[model samples]
Target: MEASDARVVYVHGNGNKVREDLLKSQWDTALFGADMGAATRMAYWAPLRYPAPLSDAGEDPIDGGPGGPVGFEAPDAPAAEPPDAFIARTLAEARLDATLGGAEGLVPSAPGATGDPAEAEAALGEWLRDMTYLGDTLAEGESANTVPGSDAGLEALPLPRAARTAVFRLLVEHTFKDVHGYFFGGAGPAMREVFTRALDAVAVPDGGALVVLSHSLGTIIAYEALRERPRDVDLLVTVGSPLAITEIRDILLQPPAVPAGVAAWCNASDPRDLVALDHTLRPEYAPVELVTDHLVTNDSGNHHGIREYLSTRPVRDPVRAVFDGLASGQTQ
Candidate 1:
């Protein structure tokens, strides 16, 4: 896919572009003495929101043909309820304040999950299983595989793979679910409305192939988006993606968005980084092709330097594979 042909949507994680101070401070803590300018430039990309009505309850389905799936499914529709309910449950479990913290509580809405709160609640419990550090704790009671910058002696680090993946999951959840209630409350309906509007604004013209290059939490968002709208996605490349986080894989309760279409995914990670430890991006779903890329680098700049790892050989190879896969139409 030509760079211009592909509509590479860079979905940022956790904070907003307008909220630069907060974003910088959070990043500073993670990187630890790293150059702020470089990290910001490499990580910061595009904001995916656009103007739209905040609440669409009883409103006509916003056109998803252009933007994607903001209002793709009908309200009170059976298919739409599961994701919504799931999001509501997630917020409740995290004990988050949905609107204040800018967290996405649910997929469609964080409130009712179509109409089945009980089912949604159950699913939410399963999903939270992967968010905690215990998710990575082995039954055998063995120590976790170490990743660079993962020394608990310093900051009580989470299992590298689980940490990044859980962070990604929560960040994505923040985009849609309300965070305040003990178990479920205000979902980020406005943010979903914005995302739907933005995708509609930048509608992929001519059915040309589009490739999404994501890192860390961005990767999780991309995966969920694909799960919701697989028809719109062509190539998905995740670098330092924590898809393998035990809780994320175990808990999130939605089915594949694109169940039949063949979408290519390229997952790249560094063995020693700890964030992608034992799990980053391993293709488990069908009709979605996965090609693994190892961001082969030492433990020196581990977890915090995902953007830095992009220049290394392992990371580049799978990126090339994505391009190559698009060209050849087959190769893992």
Candidate 2:
């Protein structure tokens, strides 16, 4: 079969997103100048997380697309917190313990503690100071210096330090929430079902190439799905994935190895992308030789944006090569 006939299946990451059609179009434009017609498909699972899709006018907080950052209210009811091992581990790796602690301090003091308004005000001030220090430390890359930008690549964002910290906090919260829901909220089977259906929908004929492109939490979904039901995937591309984290790896169907159905696995990440802190999957996954990892600069303000990651050469070229018939078992 010719490479032009190859099919591409995209799996999006966490958080409520725009309508499925719009989301797919945005991704299509970023990866390919124009839609590939029936050659491409998106496994959209946002409806499972949010009751309704965000209006076209609203900005996706996670993506930071158009309209800038928007205020997001916390969930009114406490979400089920089944074993937070993944959340705890991810925060520690990101060095956000202090930032979270400061946020906790912002809450009103206990009933017995301070009746005086003056004292309460003082406590609030102290918490603010601590949070400021923590934010500065993160921005300066003192403790969580994983990315080139001291602020984990958030410094480039136009927002002030406090605002940047809040944005990062929200991002982390939403990211872990979705991940937790997928693993423990009884959403795993359903999410994987969505992926399975999409994969099966691909019209690739016998011997035709098939590529799976997944980002962030989508990477986790793709990995497990491909692992559970082996298929002939010409290439599996993952970006901003948290699969490298030990906690995440531990919970997945063990023993860790490249999905058997995948002929070649290419993982790309920006050094500043906290979600993909580990940056490389070659050493962790089994049959290490088959997994190739590349580091690219994601100019997206947050450095974790899917569009920026998709636009990078390391990512775009490989996918394009598969369609161009230039890619073999491994990406050039």
Candidate with top TM-score is: 2
Residues 163-215 of candidate 1 have per-residue lDDT tens digits of: 23333334344322212221133233333333344345454546345545555
Lowest lDDT 10-residue stretch of candidate 1: 60-69
Report backbone clashes per prediction: 34, 0
Best by lDDT: 2
lDDT of 2 by residue, 34-110 (tens): 76667789999988889999998776656544442222211221222111322333233333333434333222323
What is each predicted model's overall lDDT from 0 to 1?
A: 0.37, 0.64
Which segments of candidate 1 are over 4 A away from where they belong? 1-3, 15-196, 205-207, 255-262, 287-289, 298-302, 313-332
lDDT of 2: 0.64
Model 1 score (lDDT): 0.37
